[model samples]
Target: MVVGGDAAKEYVAGFAAGVATVIVGHPFDTIKVKLQTHNTKTQVKEYKNAIHCTSQILRSEGVKGLYRGASSSFIGMAFESSLIFGIYSQAKQLLQGETESIKPQLQVIIPSAAFGGALISFILCPAELVKCRMQVQGRDSANSNYVRYAGPLDCALNTMKSEGVKGIFRGGFTTLLRESIGNATFFSTYEMSRHYMHLQLNSNSSARSQQSKILSDVGIGIISGGLAGMAFWTAVLPLDVAKTLIQTAPDPNSSRDPFRTLGSIYSRVGLKGCYAGLGPTLARAFPANAVAIVTWEGAAKLLGVKRD
Candidate 1:
């Protein structure tokens, strides 16, 4: 039997997932954005590596620095995850139709996941734009006059007033590309891993008691989700690096085309430049997404969403 629930249930579960994500992942995300934006021709590299970055943030700005733009991310990710999970569930259900197979087909899963990702990009872009800008601020310690945003809302208002509505969506296309491709890889890997683990663990899982089955599912979900999270960053860190650069550029008039910007980065600094922040990103991926999936599953269960 296919595992799923009504769209509303998935949305609620996904909100829980998103919240878990930000809490576990935001510190790593801050390091990733800072790494991506700082190592450029025009700017002096502020961090030698993820360790250096973490230490610097700790010493200078305290733990709060690592969560600079978390408020915006919390809001954005809650809505984004809700929509992405809801759309993915609904689309997969629609695509599967009357099919009775418990095993997920890539043909159905990839497109469904990608479609959800593409749709959520619209919501993600502005929130990320604000988040990136906030994350990258305070780097210029020498400039005593640099004014930081009071908060997420203040940052958004300032961006809108200065760059207009378009400014809020500065790196939208990059966000779209990243989400669509990354999510396709993400969900596909999770489903495939889950299926493999299910087969290996139980020749007769269905015969197990409800509690045993739930426990098995939770264990499998945690591993699969972690692997899936790692897979996502491995597939798209270069694109993510490009997205960060585009969103956090000091010059508003800078090129916004992600591919072209990536090309520029490649020309200037080669492959390493395109893959900036790989360390913290991969480190953050496994635990963050594992928690997200666990939370999601727990929420779904609490809400009485049905499963296999």
Candidate 2:
């Protein structure tokens, strides 16, 4: 029987893992976003490409700029990953039942991921808002006189001052849609792959061992994470593109209709524009999710969680 106490413990452990992950990976994430969402005609040719962009950021903004919005990322991840792993584990346990015979199949995994994804979206939206704003700062159109926000706090305060609390949640609905579907694909693919790997190993008794299990776990995690990220972005690239526009739209007073916004994006850049951020997203996902899944599983083991 999965108790509330178990769920709480899992949440805390997941939160710790999330903190560790963000610390290590947030800088890369910031870079990825900047590169993916680079302004169209900035004279800052230093950022005209990825390598140049990275070096320029390092040279100009120092290490701190690489980690801009990291604090908000930590806050967002704490709630998002914690709830995701916690709910995912609990849901898996509930659906699969406390039995060793439970086979990892889409039936049990997909819904669990879907539920976890929905829960994480609520936590991800606001933090992501802050992260995007921070990443794009100082790079806005030079001709414009937009107020410069110093950091995450300033962004938040200024957002509230100008647009009220609701401003802070801009694009939250699209965020929810993207993350829910994206993470659903993420966990479902991960669990299904892990199960297949374990099953293959177990089928050959000679291959069944602790080392094999560890290897299988890591391999499945990497493959699944990468594939899932690809699947996610491909499936919802349009929504993601729209979300980015809504969150970073230069003019806050611009029309807020999602359909119109999506249409404008499509017309301006064609379908390819919708997938502008795929490169960085894939790069970040490969490592970030590898760390996330391995850490979550390792912590679960340390906590003596057993599949039953």
lDDT, each prediction: 0.87, 0.71
- What clash pairs does model 2 have? 98-308, 99-308
Regions of candidate 1 where Cα sits further than 4 Å from its true position = 1-5, 42-44, 139-147, 204-211
Query: Which one is best on TM-score?
Result: 1
Cα displacement (Å) at residue 282, model 2 = 0.7
lDDT of 2 at 15: 83
Please give the TM-score that candidate 1 achieves against the real structure.
0.94
Which regions of candidate 2 deviate over 4 angstroms? Answer: 1-5, 39-47, 96-101, 139-146, 205-216, 257-259
Q: Model 1: per-residue lDDT, tens digit, 12-64?
A: 99999999999999999999888888775443566889999899888888999
TM-score, predicted candidate 2 vs. hidden true structure: 0.85
